[model samples]
Target: MIKKLFIIIACILLLSSCSNRVDKGKLNKVGMLVPETINDQVWGTKGYKGLLNIQNDFDVDVYYKEGIENASAIEHAVSEFKQKNVNLIFGHGFEYADTFNKIAKKYPTIHFVSFNGDATQKNTTSLRFEGHAMGFFGGMTAAHMSTTKKIGIIATHSWQPEIKGFVEGAKYEDPNITVLLKYTDNWDDGQKAVGLLDKLLDEEVDVVYPAGDGFNVPVIEKIKEKGLYAIGYVSDQSDLGKNTVLTSTIQQASKLYDIVAKKYAEGTLQSGNLSFDFQDGVIEMGKFSPRVDEKFQRKMKRFVKKYKETGDLPK
Candidate 1:
């Protein structure tokens, strides 16, 4: 009777251990695909850090391949993750929308997530913020700080949403303020931004706000030389131009990743789009420049308070 009881207890312990191993294995597999090198400081780097946070928090197996640009490359990378049976996959840009939408059809079991994108499929989820909301915050600062009553927004493309928000925000501060809009054909070309800056300066733009990634450095450099003010985007680029940059509108990428990851781990993450905004705390305002006086800071605080309360810009 004692021998039989021991045999039954050992069999039960072995089965429980195997079951636990399988469950832990399923929870550990997380993969990410970055469109560019993870060293880009703002966009790519933030995504990388977010994944790292997810790994650290969940104690999961993490894999990432950077510089995977284009539809074919994204497809290949995601396919490899699928083969490895990664439980979740994150594609960190809007550019991955179509590819993820297409590929997600084949893998119904894996959860696909996108940052700064739309989720069109059932198995996919997206976390995107309104760029215009952040642009509005920057524009409001620029309008208030401009001595010339003229401000400029520079970007690689028109980006109507951000431009519209900038204009609206400026008009909210002072209806008579002039808002100049300039677009460089390329995002990284410093010369293009310089040429655009010359035009904006010719029109007496005293506060220049750069919306394009990487364009902030060159534009801020020129703004500093001209003894003018500027606003940064994506990251807190105040360090890039301390006295010149009045403030920045930031994207909290890692925080967003952690939010989604927790939901996923809890098996509560849903499909479709998750639209984040200033109200959602994903779109944030960076530190105010020392040049920004306490009076204006108080006013900004009030504006933000009103926004949070009403879900609309203060009139």
Candidate 2:
């Protein structure tokens, strides 16, 4: 067990330390596709941050197309990348996957990555996180801090494995806890998310988390305006309003980008599949903002240790 953990740790160190570029000549172009701009401060921000980090680490030239919504736009974007023989294409959000998979289907030579998704192909891989592992933590934190047992989750989509993972995670932590969960079916609509937040607030949910891509700005604002607590998502967003945010679930974009770009450069890139669960450190909790209680801190520690030691959540 120690050996396995040490190896995982070693891989992490190596991946983090890797920065040698084999002269990222203009040989192959890379495209980083986003459903929204980095201005959103959530998923798109993390993805865009990943793109810049990769470019900084390696000498590769990156082409980015941001604010792509809808299947047609995504399809067109992928098609554009393939026509340019882009080395690797990174698509953010599950909504972009079907379109990417369709475009990647005909282009076997190009490599593709779908972030926050679990779809696959020979040249395309789906990379997802076990947010369920942390969702329990989020829930417990919310439960502890919430004046009402009512906590809320505003997700980007209605239902999916990732969302289900959060549901299972939260319920596993407290079966009797009341959670008000909803989805906007869109990632860019802060107005919609704000409206949802208002509704959840009407339900008396004090602790909330917005799991939409970059739409967290408004959510955090609402949390602050109402003098409530919230858990941030995608990146380490506690800094947005440190007083209002407890902690956050960060999808390590640069870390994933490092591994993918390294493997692709090494010609040993794993094809057809890719994923990073919480156990893999792909999903991590941000530093807790100041003033979090010892009780909630202990809960997070216990849950993390339980998962790490037993490879399962505590029931």
- State the TM-score for model 2: 0.82
lDDT of 1 by residue, 1-315 (tens): 999999999999987655543223335478888876788887778888988887766767789999787889988888888788787888887677778888888888888888656788988988776777677778888998999999998887775467788888888888899998998877567788889999999999999888876577778888999899989887888997678999998878887887777778777888988877777677788899999888988888787777767887766
Q: Rate the local accuracy (lDDT) of all candidates.
A: 0.81, 0.74
Instruction: Give the top-scoring candidate (lDDT).
Output: 1
Clashing pairs in 1: none
Assess the local accuracy of residue 215 in candidate 1 as a C-alpha lDDT between 0 and 100.
73
Model 2 segments more than 4 A misplaced = 1-27, 70-85, 116-120, 160-175
lDDT of 2 at 211: 85
Cα-based lDDT at residue 61, candidate 1: 77
RMSD of 2: 8.2
All candidates' TM-scores? 0.86, 0.82
